[model samples]
Target: MTTLPQISLAKLAATATRREERQRLQMACEEFGFFYLVEHGIPKEQITQAIEASRRFFALPQSIKERYGHAAQGMYPTIARGYSRLRGEILHPDAGPDPKEVFDLGIDSEGDRRPFAGSTRFPDDALAPGFARSLLALQTTVLDGVVPQLGTALADLIGMEEGWFPRHFSPPTLGQRVIRYPARGGTCAKHTDGGFFTLLLQEELPTRSLQVWFRERWMPVPSLPDSLVVNLGDMLQALSDDRFKSTPHQVAHSGESDRISLPFFIYPDIDACLTSCQGRHAFRVAEMMLRNFESVEAGNGAGRARELQ
Candidate 1:
């Protein structure tokens, strides 16, 4: 029974003397690649609002929800926003499709057509008032404040030159999802996040669903109402030369009642060229991101995960 390391974001953000907490973060990144981040400055109300809004959105009739469905459901063929019904994604191929429904959105840019960019299709305010605003407010706070501070700390741990990460990381491309795991279906299969890192806020019910790979077995990461669960992902693993692994984990929603979790994926500017730590090769952010999504969308993420690992 391994305990996921709990690191204080405030301590990590402390001035020059923050080395101790920074080292702890590095250790967590190296050993477990997952940790509970406390003191992360997100308001309790924002979280509550998002979760409540998600519940309302999901509780709507199927016909009403489908009005905002992905084109595959026969909406906008070019965009991949809005609602996706149950069994829509299979993060781990072996376990088959996930028994989950998801509503996804990125930063709402009016007409930007770049990959993972452009305006989001949100449910009307009359239906779910404050839904988009609440989620985006939470995201904006994290992205603008906590995310950069944490990234700088990690960069220091990895010995990246000053300003290296920020040089090409302006206005990062991000995706946020409000995901629901039904009470009866199987778990979200084992898989690692595909971005630089992820900010996860798990709903307060069924507190024992998330587990991470550690020391040759699955270890539980029970939910803590006040903290965010952070984890390393493939991009960071690549940038750090595998020093920080993107640990594989899965969800096994237990007991009765539905479970919802929000995950915010962070990526660099699409045109940025990321050179490996060892300078082995450089790749464009857009190509890497598209390949990651395309593989999963095509149900071949298991193979892609193997390659990245």
Candidate 2:
């Protein structure tokens, strides 16, 4: 009967002494690896608008949605950065084909640039007005405010100087994905996020889908309105020498209706090197992504093989 903890960013921001906030965040990162974050400064209306826009996009004809696919018009085929149809590819093949559709976008360059930085594909304004704007606004909020605050707190927790973690992100590599999960048995299989961390904005639609690995069992994370789920990622675990757990989690069928969520995967600069207790391994962001794709391909093949047996 383990439960998730909710922490407020406002308290972490305004308080003179951050000892308690740092300790709490560190504990959550070490123990649960996931928590509910409130007062994150993103307007609730903007979140609602983003969710509604996702729903509208999903409701469109499959042909129309396919126009934004990776092979469609203007999308980067090197990475997972475009519209993917339901069961199009298995990210986690252990649970079989994923019963979900996703639209992925990477960092929209603003002056500072990186290899994978670019604008996102979007439908015409007549079809989906304000969709791109709302999504980008929310992403900007996380990049400008929330992520750096967490990074600062993390530096404090790790006994580093105030700006250590934030300074590493001179130009971050980010990807935002809007997902739609249909009412099926399994939506997404268990897996760890493949970045520094994630800011998940999920709809509070009376669904019990998201579960985290805790106490050697899967524990449910309740959906609360106007809040975001902040979770650690594999890179953080490696950077901290496994001091902070990047726990595995999965999404199941809501069974009531389609579920939509927005997850902003935040990463450090592509060329930044990470140091851990093990040693200093130069982990490039693009290389890590390539490994993930390779794993997915292997897993998908293994899944098909097991199905034959």
Candidate 3:
């Protein structure tokens, strides 16, 4: 078993109060670009339930799954929007299409009218009982516990008050993606997340393989119980004046059973600016991601672009 680096939030938070820990976290972000966060406040049962719900939902028949598809943005079952590979297009010319199918959910807000906003399609009792509620409950709990902490930590990393981020993320556009990667014959090609940060809870270990970009190389990120993997997106990297990095990563083909992962993406305010604050680093990250998003949507996947809002 590979013993990956671990950061106990309780200890890190305790150390953060001492200024030295704060420096350590900032350095970690700069150097590793990804980290395994332990002792995060979310309970074990909640995580388990979320995974269980995801498995149940994905296990539904394909005909039933398509009923909830978001055709406009390519959001639907077995298809990934923005991050999933195009039909018949290999993520890596050398590799096959990513074997993952996905369903996405966003914050339920009335009259928000954002590009990604709307009521998510839920199966009725005929399809599955209590499915939507269970999934939403899990989403709420995970976001409620993780987002604020991540925001505050990020603010501190940039020399701002811990509460500074909430001002921008108030009623944030929270998005949830339920992904199912079939056996290792197909895998996600190399790509970066489109949101500011991604919190992934793995339902099972990687049957094929999972890898993350770090220190200018692709390193395997092992799946462990009770641990969530955190990765900085392009926006964070740009906002930090390149202090933090949004590294590129991919999932390799697995010949065993399929893999499932539930990822909750936290996006920044769409209209937020990308300039430096109080002599801190500039906020060009969001802008960079936007540009990358557009390019990707324009059929130029080979270009190094970031995620879209």
Best by the TM-score measure = 1
TM-score of each: 0.93, 0.89, 0.81
User: Candidate 3 residues 92-198, lDDT tens each?
Assistant: 43334456776677776555454455466567656665566766887777767777776678766866565668877775656687667776454677777656777
Please write out the lDDT profile of model 1 over residues 133-243, one tens digit for every residue.
Answer: 788888888888788888888877877889976875677778788898888553778888877888898776645888887888888888876989998887888888889
What is the lDDT, from 0 to 100, of the residue 215 in candidate 2?
81
| Pairs with steric clashes in candidate 1 | none
lDDT of 2: 0.75
Q: How would you order the candidates by TM-score, starting with the best?
A: 1, 2, 3
Candidate 2: regions farther than 4 A off: 73-77, 110-115, 184-186, 277-282, 297-309
Off by over 4 Å in 1: 72-80, 302-309
lDDT assessment of candidate 3: 0.62
What would the per-residue lDDT of candidate 2 be over residues 106-176, giving only the tens digit for each residue? 77664433445666668876777777777888787778878888767765665555566767776577878
In terms of lDDT, the best-performing candidate is 1
Rank list by lDDT: 1, 2, 3
